[model samples]
Target: MMRWLITGGCGFMGSNFIRYWLKNHTEDYILNLDKLTYAGNPDNLKMIENHPHYRFVLGDITDPQAIESLVPEFDGIINFAAETHVDRSIAQPRDFILTDMVGTYNLLEAARFHQKKLIQISTDEVYGNCPSGQNTEQAPLLPGNPYSASKGGADLLCLAYHQTYKVDVMITRSCNCYGPYQYPEKLIPLFITNLLEGKKLPLYGDGSCIREWIYIQDYCSALDIVIQKGKTGEIYNISTGEGIPNLEVTRLILQEMGMSEDLIEMVDDRQGHDRRYSLDASQIRQLGWNPEYLFSMGLKETLQWYRHNENWWRKIKSGEYQQYYRQQYAQRHKKSTLER
Candidate 1:
């Protein structure tokens, strides 16, 4: 059985990954480390907390001692920890730099010293907005804002460790992920929840920005391939080989929700908003990995999830989310934030 330590296990993608991994790899042991931040809710993993192979530890990645002690104890390290929201990153850039960049540095150093296989879960945002064709693994890094820049910076440190110190690290940059257990503030869930509440479906700018989307389960499957067979010091791009504009995606989700297109609330575009992004996921397919769910099926499933799990996001939309947003960016910005 593999002993694995996973950071950010309480977040959206992290939570889904943990659930998927446990069910698939029954022989593995996972120590889930999360800070239980405003976005993190342990209820996401309540179903598996008592699983014999699963363990939960409340902590932050920036805490060097906390990460160091655990690094030596696990056979592999999968880092899902980060300040993930781009809008929130724009609102609080310093936290992004600290958690996304510095936190990664801390984990890398710990893993390097322990000689553990480290898996860095990343996003396609590192390549910025690719308006035309898809971005291959060699695509130049051009982060358009603090959030992407921070993530790119962390990836650099991972590569540098591999080059300079021969650290065992495999990085996977996946396209925009959507599925169950995601924080309610994200694009799909936000629109879903807003529609249910009869609120405006906030669409940034003209909602024309294009993005390659992948179901969360498929994204996790790619990571599973990386952890099992991918080469160290290499990057894998995970996507569904389909690009959809934010406006069209919103329309599709709203249409499924039985909501009118006029319910969309057009808002000013985000600062440094990406125009489009697409990933060439050929490499992961070469490694015997592929996306399973189509966008239509995934969207329908996600909508049903939110509809069934109102209490989960409702608690977040009310308690921790309100306090965290206010405390982090209340008086700082004056754009009337809506928890994007």
Candidate 2:
């Protein structure tokens, strides 16, 4: 059985991947290493916490020494640890640099030294705004913000390592992912949870910015296929090939939640927000993987999940997150004069 080390396994995408991995690959062993940042919630994987084939370790990937000691024990590594929130990245760029870039450098080093396979989880924002067409893996990296820049830097590092040291590394850059267990800071979950809580949906800018949305389950399957069939030293883009504007998405969320459009509160746009991010996922589709859930179905599933699990997101919106929300949005809220 293969033993894999999953970094940032407590975070939204990572945690969902672990649950997906364990359920599908019962024979494989997994060791989850996470720093347990505010976004990394252990409760996301509580159902499989006691599984014999899976274990959790509290650690940070930024520490080279810790990574060195851990890399030798696993057959391969999947680096998912990252500072992902764009607003937070804008507010605190250093954190994104440390976690997304430096942390990736450390993981690449360990993977190189140990000669182990590494799959770097990435985002489509690295391609910057794709206003006209879908970006293939050959697109140039023109990241618009601190978070994307850091991720883009790490992608370059992975390619560099492969060219210079022959490291077994592959990268997967996907579009926006939404589903159960996602931290409510992102657009979809934020709107869903906000509507549920009787709070206003803070619509950024004119809400005309467009993005492709993919269900987490579909993304997990794509990643699984990539791990099994993808060639080393290559980059793969995963997308649904559908881009929806922010306002339209907000309307869909409101409709799904049975809320009115009046709930949308115009807020200050994010600094350096990309207008669009589209990926040509045709490459991975050749590996016999296709998204099963359409945006409408996926959004409905996500809304139902939050509706059923009110306690989960409610706890997250309180305390520290509340302070963060106010700090991040309070000033921006001032610029808004529209409530509908």
Q: lDDT values of the candidates?
A: 0.87, 0.89
Expressed as tens digits, the lDDT of each residue in 104-175 for candidate 2 is: 999999999999999999999999998897899999999999999999999999999999999999999999
> Clashing residue pairs in candidate 2, if any?
none
CA displacement after TM-score superposition, residue 6 of candidate 1 (Å) = 0.2
Off by over 4 Å in 2: 320-340
TM-score of every model?
Answer: 0.93, 0.93
Q: Tens digit of lDDT per residue, candidate 1, span 1-340? A: 8888899988899999999999999988888887767777777888986787887777789899988877887898888999989999889899889888999999999988888888999889999989888899999999999999999999999999999989999899999999999888899999898888888988999998998889998898888888888998999999998799899999998889887899988999999899998999899999999788999999999999999999878877768555654344323322321110
Looking at model 2, residue 111 earns an lDDT score of 94
- The CA-based lDDT of model 2 is what? 0.89
TM-score of 2: 0.93
